[model samples]
Target: MAKILVVDDAKFMRMTLKNILTNGEHDVIGEASNGKEAVELYKELAPDLVTMDITMPEMNGMDALNEIVASSDDARVIMCSAMGQQKMVVEAIEQGAKDFIVKPFDEARVLEAVARVLR
Candidate 1:
């Protein structure tokens, strides 16, 4: 199990993610509503993994993903967005996201992505 940061604008999504990760025995170090908060908390918590949502009120996840990667090459980020565009996924990978997961999160997929990134 890894320390994880869950970033999403939706409260329910964050809570749901928390439940799943906790069940998987991973400690959720922190949660962020947007990419900006994600970055700031990222610096503070420095979790083993970050699950980020794409669209938000301020500072989208991709930009935050880039920022985090720029700040720390060791940062392991998993993009969790509703966006299924091939270009977006490719760009996220190019920008240093370790993995991608679609929203309306599946417990299996989420855990699988986390495990893959942590590996």
Candidate 2:
């Protein structure tokens, strides 16, 4: 099972992702409320994957993705975004995000993205 870090400003969103990941048999090693916390947790936890929300307080997912990728060559990040954030999602992909799940998340899609990224 892959160790995953879930990052989102909303507690409910975080919880949803945690449930999905755990049900899929992946271990959620840590969770962060914002990009800054996400960067710190990533350094400490070194999780196999990260599910990052695009918009958040403090810093955004794109920035966090950049930071994690810079710190680790093999960082695997799946960006989470709202329906109309296609521009941001494209930018995230360019910035090294492995994949993306649009909110509100789909359980199968989330699991599929995680599995694909892990592979």
Candidate 2 vs. true structure, TM-score: 0.99
Listed in order, each prediction's TM-score against the native is 0.95, 0.99
lDDT of 1 at 94: 90
Displacement of residue 14 (Cα, Å) in model 2 is 0.3
Tens-place lDDT digits, model 2, residues 32-90:
99999999999999999999999999998889999999999999999999899999999
Worst 10 residues of 1 by lDDT: 81-90
- Model 2: weakest 10-residue lDDT segment is 57-66
Candidate 1 per-residue lDDT over residues 64-92, each given as its tens digit: 99999999979999988685565787899
Could you give me the TM-score of model 1 versus the true structure? 0.95
Residue 14's lDDT within candidate 2 is 99
lDDT of 1 at 63: 93
* Clash pairs, model 2 backbone: none
* Model 2 score (lDDT): 0.96
In angstroms, the error of model 1 at 10 is: 0.6
